[model samples]
Target: MKEERELQDVLVQLSSLAPGPADAPKPAGQALAVIKRQVKQEKRAGCQPWQRFWQNPNRRWATAVLSLLILFTVAFSFPAVRAAASDFLGLFRVQKFAAISVSSEQLALLERVAEEGVSPGELTIVNAPGALIPVNSLAAAARETGLEQVLSPAALGEPDEIDVVEGGDGRLIIDAAGARRIIELAGADPTLFPEKLDGKRVEVVIFSGVQQSWDDGTVLLQTTMPLVEYPGNLDPVPLGEAMLQMLGMNRNEAARLARTIDWTSTLLLPIPRNVATFNEITINGSSGLALASLDGQYGAVMWQQNDVLYLLTGSGDTVELQRIANSVR
Candidate 1:
C-alpha cells in the first residue's frame, strides 16, 4: 500500500511536470516504425501498465537504469540489453553477475513512473548507435563483428539464422538538477546525489556482437566487452545508492547493496522473486547466473568467458540450459 500511495503521488507530480511539445530529435524511421507498432499492439492487447513493463525482452538491470535516465530527461532529452560496469580504466565489461531482488510492488511503481511520467517525444535520441544486420554465415558474422572466436552451441547444431549487431559510441549528458528533483518527488533522499555529478556526461560504447536464432525459439547472443565511461571525478557508489533508494529501498539497505557491488565490472540482474528463480551456477570453469521462470518453462544462462559475454535463452530447464551453454565453442 505504501508503494501504491507513492505511485499515485508520483503520477500526480508527473502530470504537472509534463513538458510542452518541442522539436526533439527522434529515432530513425525504421526504429520509429517498430516503436509505433509495438505501442499499437500493446494498446490492442489492453495489458495493464505493469504487465506491459515486463513485456520487454531485454528487461535487464541496464534497461531499468536506462529507463530511469529517460524518466529524468523527459523534459529535455534521452538506452541497451546487456548489463556491464567499468574497470579502473573507465572501460566496462561484464566480469560477474549479481542478482538483486525486486518486489512486485516496486516493479509496479517503476512502471507507473515510466508510463505516466514520460513520453516518447520528450526523449531526444542524439545518436543511433547500431543496428542488427543479418549475416549469411558464421564466418560473415565474425568478419562483421571482428570477433576472432565466434561461438555456437555444439548441442544445437547449426543455427537457422545469424545476425551481426553493429556497435558504436553514444553519450548521455545528465540533467542532474532534473534527476534530483525526480528523486525527491519519489520520496527518496535528495542529499544522496553528488553535487559534482551535475552536467557530467556518461559515455557508452556498444561492442559489436552476434545473435543466432533457431527455428525452435532458442537465442544465443555473444558480444565483446561493452564499455561505460563515467567521469573521473564521479564515484558511482552514491549515484547507485540514490537510484536504489528511489526504487523504494531503505537507505541502509540500499547503501549496503551499492557498496557490495563493483559498479564498474558487475552486471546487476533484477530478479522478481514472485516470477522467477535465480541461482549462481558454474558453467564449465566460469561462474554464471542461471534464471528460470517460476513455471519452469523457460530459462537462461549468462556468463563471461575470455572477455566475451554470452547469453543463452530457450524453453528449457536450467540443466538443459547449462548443457547447451557448456557446448558453446
Candidate 2:
C-alpha cells in the first residue's frame, strides 16, 4: 500500500509537468527525484501490477519509446553530444563523388608494398618545354633499353612528337595539364587528381601526347585530345642474369635455366574482382583483361606483351579500342 501511494504521488507530479511546451523549462529536482526513487523501488521489487502492465506488447513499446525520448533529451542537453551528432549526420551531404575513392583491397596492396620496402621503380617529373628531352634527341643507350620503347599504337596514328624525360634522376614533375590528362587516361575525374600538380613529382612513367591533327598519327578519333600512356614491364630482366650475378653461376647453366623459366605471367595487374564487369581478351594470342563500366563502356584495358604490361583507358568505344590495342607496337 505504501509503495502504491508513493507511485501515485510521483505520477501526479509527472502529469502536472507533462502539459507544458516540449522545450519548456525542465521539471523540478524534487519531482524528478521522487519519480526516480519510485521507479527504482518498483523495478527492484518487481511490482506485480507494474510487471503485468509491461507484459502487454503495446505498453512495452510505449515504455521503450519513452526511454528513448529521455535519452535523446539528455544527449542533446550536452554540447559535445550535439556536436558529434551534427558531424555524424554530415556524411549524407550532397556532393560529387570522385574516382579517387579507391577500394580497401587497393589500399591494402599499397600498405603491403610499403611494408615490404619494394622500390616503386622509375619516377618522372615533366618540366617546361626547355627541360624536356625530345624523343628524337634520346641517347642511343636509353633507346636500347625499355626507357625509350615507343608504346604509341598504330591505330591511334603516328604521334606528333615525343619527349625523353630523365626526370632529374628518376623524380618526375608533372604540371596541372599533365595531371588532368593522366586522370582522363584513367577515366577518372580531374578533381580526384592532385590539385597542385605543377612541379609535383611522382614515380609513374608518363608518356604525354597531344594531337595537333588526325593526319599526323593521332590515335584518338578526336583531334587535339590529350592522350597519356603509363606503360609497365617494358624491360624484362632474366632470372638467369640474377643467378649468374648473385650466385656466380656459369653463363651456360644460367642461360639454360632462364630459357626454361616462363616470364609471361610476370606482367600482371591486380585488378579487384568486385568491379562491375571483367572480360577476358586476347592480344596477339596472349590473355588480357578488360574492365567495363556500369553503363557498358570500356573503362580500361590491360594486356601483357614481350613481358610488358600495357594499360589503355579512355572514353572510347570497345571495338575501336581493340583495333587501337593492335597498333601498340
lDDT, candidates in the order shown: 0.65, 0.36
Residue pairs of candidate 2 with colliding backbone atoms: 124-172, 125-172, 125-173, 126-173, 153-327, 154-327, 156-218, 156-219, 157-217, 158-217
Among the numbered candidates, top lDDT falls to 1
The ten-residue window of minimal lDDT in model 2 covers 91-100
- TM accuracy, model 2: 0.30
Worst 10 residues of 1 by lDDT: 79-88
How many pairs in model 2 have backbone atoms within 3 A of each other, for residues 3 or more apart or on separate chains, i.e. clashes? 10
Per-candidate alpha-carbon RMSD to the true structure? 17.3, 28.8
lDDT of 2 by residue, 1-329 (tens): 99999999999988876745765656699789987998888889876643533554433332232222122111121232211111111111111111112344543443342344222122333342112234452233145333434456766654554433222112333344443432233223334333443554333222222111123222221111111221233222242222222222345664564455443222212233343354677766666655554454335455555434444554455555566777766
At residue 207, give the lDDT of candidate 2.
28
Model 1 residue runs over 4 Å out of place are: 1-91, 115-130
lDDT of 1 by residue, 193-234 (tens): 666656666666667888887877677878886666667866
- Model 1 has how many clashing residue pairs? 2
